[model samples]
Target: MNASAKRLVFLLLPVLATGCARTAVEPAMSRPDFVRGEPRVTVHRDHDDLLSAGLGLAGLAGTPVPFADPAHPTAPELRRRAIQASWKGIADLGPLGGYGQAYGAVPAVPGREYQAFAWVPGARQPHRVLLQVPDGFDQAKRCLVVTASSGSRGIYGAIALAGAWGLPRGCAVAYTDKGAGSGFFDYADDSGVALDGRRARRGEAELEFTPPPLSAGAGVAVKHLHSGDNPEADWGRHVLQAARFGLAMLDRAYPEQAPFTPQNTHIIATGLSNGGGAVLQAAGLDDAHLLAGVVALEPNVQLAGQGRPFYDYATEAAIWLPCALTDASFDATPFARAPMTRGWPQRCASLHAQGLLTAATPAAQAAQAYEHLRAAGWTDNAMQVAATTTAFDLWRAITAGYASAYLRRDAAHMPCGFRYAGMKADGQPGVADTATRAAWWSDSAGIPPGNGIGLLGGTDASTDPTLAGERCLRALWDGDGADSRALRAGIDATAARLPRTDLPLWVVHGADDGLLPTAFTSEPYVAWLRAEGRRPLYWKVPHAQHFDAFLPLPGFGERHLPLLPYGYAALDRLWAHLYEGAPWPTQSSTPKGQPRGARSLTPAMLGLGAN
Candidate 1:
């Protein structure tokens, strides 16, 4: 099909599908018949107590401890036997442009027997499926499918929270391996290289450089040691495939429970960082089954263009334009030029004309731009630049890869790019113009950093050395393009569909988030959603970086300004929205605690301590 035709089909398909699949209730109506009552049993207090330990624990456990017995039956064994019995019933099928494949089961859902396969593009082997059947499944009122993130599989803590806690009362739960079985990273050894006619095996290094601040020599060492072209590509695919497979498995598993209809099955998908991205992508594309809602704790969708580049507006513009203008050994010009629009240069020039260029030195400024492009795996050599001026010569000695390495380091420290003043040389305002500050504060204030999350400082099971290796392997194997675009589009589309309102979206971010900025957390999307009449309940926790919220640590202090207590309160209010389906009480309340009934708050009212 022609480009226009393809675009038309793409746009029409979702609308048509959306119309046909429209829920019985209005999309905006939050009320549901299944309101959860106060817990009949005490909620699992700490992460460790939720799931039975041992291989039974699938996914990241919070703190290190002995393995517990399986709380649920060994349905995984039964499922394996079932798959073996009806192997011919399943077929591998590709979807979303062959980015991944789906295993189809005969009769889809509500079938007694299940058939499914896991497909990831570059993995040497497809992920194996493991299933767990909750106790008294035949007696349960509902069924749930929990999808886990990397390191989450095989870890007792994460599984318990997701499977035990996340599942509504009277529901049976099942989860997948997420391609990381045994709670450890897989090690690949090369058998081809040999000495004295004997095969020699060497353990491949799987851990990529930890999020930045690399020693001065670390970059060179990494370049020489690391084999994967893009770290994200390495692990992203497995996670995507595993997630997709998990959903398919759910389709089969859903049939066994009491309330087996599609409408009644509650499919709540969630994940942290990579897994979070998977949740967003899956939600945007698939509406089948019981995909009730999505909760992405800390997703990593690239959000650039918020700051200025290192080169002056004219020079960078020329470099980012239609030809190669930079002399950098690595041809990043093309990659840099793509994705960036002409408007970026224009905006930069406008800012420069207004004296915003004096904010930071060329090196620091260039570092920010370089980091953004590099993370996306695009280099200056990829851009088409012209050699009109001596500008390209300056960048010649500075390799795109080298620049990218430096930028990655910087990104690890502050993924959002430094605040305007922070990016400046003398702490003088560069991009901190009122407009910039407004944008920054607008995005920052809504998503508070998560505090005391265990994923940081290597305490969380998700960050277990063994799990990290598995994650690295997954990243190395999965191609990155499909997941990235899917996440971006999903967020944008979700934002577009929301009703306009100023209600905050309670967002949690790890203070150590290395991928996207904390602002990228549903805040901007929520803000955009508010513009469409939707109210978001936004909040953040300190030291809770991406993925950390999913992996809580014990006794770590809150790392942000408002700290943990305030963070929990914010979460409580958000939970009200999710459970009670009521607009935040504060949303319509005046400063004096008087009800205002959906009226937007005034600056004075918000500024006042009341309400």
Candidate 2:
């Protein structure tokens, strides 16, 4: 940045802080470069609010808003359900889970929302960006938060995480789907999700994603899995564009604050999961001093010298984690019910037949599998807790999509004969029902095995159907084939080298996070950054794991801590450091015991000062 950029931190408060007031003269602000065409602007007011889609905290905690018609739902209905679903997916929102009382409160904030398609210069399809500027936004604070979707979710993916934290603070929030969204394309009907959240024909309106032409009965296509963009490589740039979009949209909404530039605004980049990875990526690319600080929690990150890559570990889990989970000790984990774990022995059997497990009995094989995983950096907590993600078949579902994404393959060319679609009674790939299709925009997590879309492979359980595909995925990661080379290349592209910077930086991780293990992501990430001379505060919370929503089971909840409260606290800590120069704690919490039952969580349990 030039002297002009660095000198404006204290120069524009009087002229640019009055949000939403029109100016007599036209502003010199220009639209962000990646933004394509005109954006669809919606002004939320009176009854409808930005934070909860008018549902407030109480409404969000209750049942979802019913769609008048299941076959063809309205856009507003989709938006409301999307908000509720996004919230429930990220946090433990039940009364006992400490949603309303412990940390978060949903207040009504009328705001203007901007939704538009943003093109990555050489991408096949455009990613989506959304900007929400509350009517009561304090421009003098000049705070803006930009985040990416946590999983391969839609634009509202991080609403429950970053948006929940920032919007309540009167800060403008910018979100991007990061080229991975809940846009499903059904080849049979030639229909897809439109920009407005409606189901439309391929050429109707502006479709969010249109799969390459497929055979008549081909499966459903997801943007993240089938876009052929390998989008993770561009996650950082997507966040930067989202930040720019937020600033530009702020100028449009509050012309009195025209020309909202990075210099004058305190831009804070933050997120969770993949969204967390996105913010970290953006920080590395912020050579212009654009971002003032960053907070990433349990981010699925892979740095030059960090732990194992997501694809490598995910596929590894998909293959052997099942056999390991068959150990009787894991039966108490979340989703590890009898019906769910009944097939674990079968997976172990398959592993045994393939000579992967040398034990003769399933019990012995399971123990051997456990020992194998233990030697491969699988923590004791992660192995036990991962029973949840494994039972959900998330490992296979996640890896198949990532394999396709990392290889930049189209739907027709997905590896290991893996694909996604609704399943028939007989378990064959079939078209999704009208009711299922109607709710996809609001329900799908931008991944299959969700929103009624199932992964189509050889055969589920009884046959250890996903094993072959998972093995194929791992082969691509370890073999010497062309596909293997291509897959590794894409993973390399997503690698980060977050350089040392003076910006306020913080990273928090759940010590028991099984999905993106702490061993593979944050510990080494913080260590690498420190070695490079960056003094980022690192917090590793014990008793906490990824996926707070999955803590419904008594054993899971009792044994684990929710990750949200800590993340929110870190954000507060960052805010105070930015404004009050408060001391930032560099040490981990002293492993506190949590009051995890319903209505049991409190500020003291979280180690925050007091309520």
Candidate 3:
């Protein structure tokens, strides 16, 4: 399979593979005829064609889906258009009808009831849901755990991951489409669809769940939600709504399958990366009273050291290049002018005197400059100043060129979040919240002035030095609404500040997560839980990056990443304790069944100060 095919598959399903073998296989029952059911979901059969292969692991074991034109619709595009057109005709059933209805079920390896539907009623485009109900489901006893996918991915990705943990244990899983921000997941291929302007070139999976999206189209563009990066939609609310909708749809579809009603069902939420954050937010939503617990895998949240002018100075410098790269319309005016650039010379001089800022080119120069600053005996402001000039070009090369496969992958996987914009509440073209503007960015470089780089020669009106003329200079450093109280209500809701019930919370984070580091999310979350006397279990994956927890490794044969499966184990323990009166295990072992190691969050982790 090529990279494009792989990316398409990524959009449709979870990126992680199952660690456990199938324990049960019920006989395939009569498949539900979705065409006759309520217009909730559109079920597609698994076939050898690229469309079916993109959604499910069917044929095309080693066969690659040949690419035609980069402009026209490929297999994934056709499917997306079909879904959108179908969504236009869906009758408004109000809140209950919005989630649509389940058509039929396909038995996957027996015992598992896999059903696909187009829930989420009022969306501009039709979002999809892939639900799996294990054989012999009892809502009164066993609980259902819905999942959220990362970035602009659909619920299929989460469904795939849930297959590893939940489905094996008679747990039902519902994965929702995140709007129009995902690609298709192809197991046979590697090269999948690329970003087509704002919309996905292939898959119209769930869009990014950002602060702007959750505002329910307050100041953001509704059309942009299905297209371009930075749709300015509040995705947190979308996730929560979709989750509630999914549960409702499931109840309507399989009322007799389980006795647990939406009100009485013990529904928990879990996700990885952005989805992880969404689940956390979902668990915190006011309507999430039924949500029992949350298992956040590398959730996107703030950290103490992540705040600017406090800690993690050197590490902040590393973010500049990626930030600039993702912002297609990035401007170099602010860094080229005074005040912001005034200290560059002195900082460069001090750094050079201390043996920093080596090469003159973009990549080399930026690396050399950051390396020296990272070493020792360097002021925080100095390194930040020196990184201004070359970081932009360096970031450009990274997005375009092929130095690290992960870098290219990260760039490709980025959602429609970052566009050069302002922070005003006005319904303008380039006005958005800090979180939406900084999370997912384009690699293009057509940054409109005053949006990305700030005003050319003006003083910042806000007291925060990072906010220059409405342009947030510290966007990448202080991403996801750092220091902003605008979305406090949403933030608090997602953070679950007011616990709905005493459901045992568990957070398993990868210490080496490149994107959403554990220091900012799980570390502080665990501390908050401890303070609240919730006694949350916080587990760490040592030397593992974010993607590493999902994808397979070359040498270790999947055994190297023992920390990944611990999340499932934790869930098992929770289920057993909640349902079967089993004692919850205080700690979980790595995938290899070994005792996991521990690490503490420190300033040095973000390159702020010495450990």
Candidate 4:
């Protein structure tokens, strides 16, 4: 039989089936007729359009419908009018998954032009919309906006997990290509040519548990990468565009829907590493209606201030640039020393001549050097002086280049899985020694440098002679002082305007985090928040390196099963708070109790930190 005839025959065969069997086939094709026991909304979709329809249907069922727009009106009137319009729109778009029709892509940015896909399970086709929010309504809700760095390959494991968790809790997720057609995974692509005049260099191998490339219809991708080489501006624009897109999407989907409305919605911005930095910048700049909270994992805040010439000194001079120091006991005077007045080489000679090395023996100096290198690699020698230089004459001349290089590569590299032998967790003849005791110091002592302790001693406000000098010089040269000031002012202003203590925040960090030391980052932040009367939840997972806590089951190497129990439980608490408006949970006050790793951090602590 011909193809058409055979398809017809197959269709008839289902109808001809026994009574119970026939009923199943009928309901599968025809528009759902909600019977007494049927779902309020039944999702049905073809394979190609399933995800979009599924998400839209979920949004409809979970919240109130939206209203339509009205003519020109006052600010309050516009908001009320929009709310009504959104409700009506949703009501009219009722029970979305009946017809065989698929939802089309939506436009998220009007003038900019972008397409978006919304999915709800069981929908017959995808609901696609083109987003273009009205000029005044650029910051609406119901949008799923994403921002990433230029080289960011797209959403990966932990980030994807966050999206999955947020979807069920009332989020419509979307991402920007950041102008790089390839998502975050593009870095793995091989482009180098081979010497044989044939393709030999392959794309770098994929990282473990990396997410797959997204289909054209799955989400929207915007081309916003600029032509200039300004990474900061590029990043700032990426964030702003993401926020704008999110607002436009919200307007299109929910129109006038409340809670999801621009002013009422609780927008939570989060990202990892560079993406995390984008979220912070976006939130800091436009916290109104766009960002309610921020979760920046391994964010690079240091780069934000690198424009200052004072901070650029270290990068200018190659001193202490290659070592990885992490000792907590060493004094800070040596590391923070600047180049001598006479000259770099002359300074070294003078220090050698003075025999100042005898005062702080090589062993003691090694301990200090090792500590800084272990945590943050090497400090730029120039920046070190600007940050903490005490005696430019004596300390600057003492060139510790040999010790720095030895500890940086040979000694420090071995302990944390490198081949070289160094310190071990138990102070054994291995690299792991540093990892073990480092957590204790971070948890018990506020960051060493800031607290005026350990290797960073004398660098604090009291001892550092160049502290004021550096600050004044940096402020004088900062061209973007206005932008920096605006960001700080925005944060402060937002804190004052939205002084609601009801929102609970939680923070989670791995004790052995190498990239951003927990001791210097989150731990200190949490302490400040607490001192300010905000009971922030803080959890320090031992042995759990940064990003490890968020890994999926059969982790990167399948070495340890990812512990998502804490994350899961924290979500439950969050849902309760969001839906029932329950009282927020308190911060964990108990001392260290659990063993190192994800499980060591409890749900309570996670929830606390999330606040």
Candidate 2 structure quality by residue, lDDT tens digits, 106-195: 788777788889988898988999998888888778789899988887888898878888987889999999998788888878888877
lDDT of 4 by residue, 356-397 (tens): 222244344434333434344333332222222222221211
Error of 1 at 271 (Å): 2.1
Give the higher-TM-score candidate: 3 or 4: 3
- The lDDT values for all models are 0.28, 0.79, 0.38, 0.29
Each prediction's number of clashing residue pairs:
79, 2, 57, 92
Looking at model 2, report the run of 10 residues with the lowest lDDT sum: 9-18
Model 3, position 298, has a per-residue lDDT of: 69
**Which residue runs does candidate 4 get wrong by more than 4 Å?**
1-151, 155-159, 168-170, 176-241, 250-260, 302-368, 371-504, 527-535, 549-572, 589-611
Off by over 4 Å in 3: 1-38, 42-142, 183-236, 257-264, 286-288, 303-498, 549-563, 585-611
Ranking by lDDT: 2, 3, 4, 1
lDDT string for model 3 (37-70, tens) is 3322322223211112222322111222322332
From the highest TM-score down, the ranking of the candidates is: 2, 3, 4, 1
Top candidate when judged by lDDT against the true structure: 2
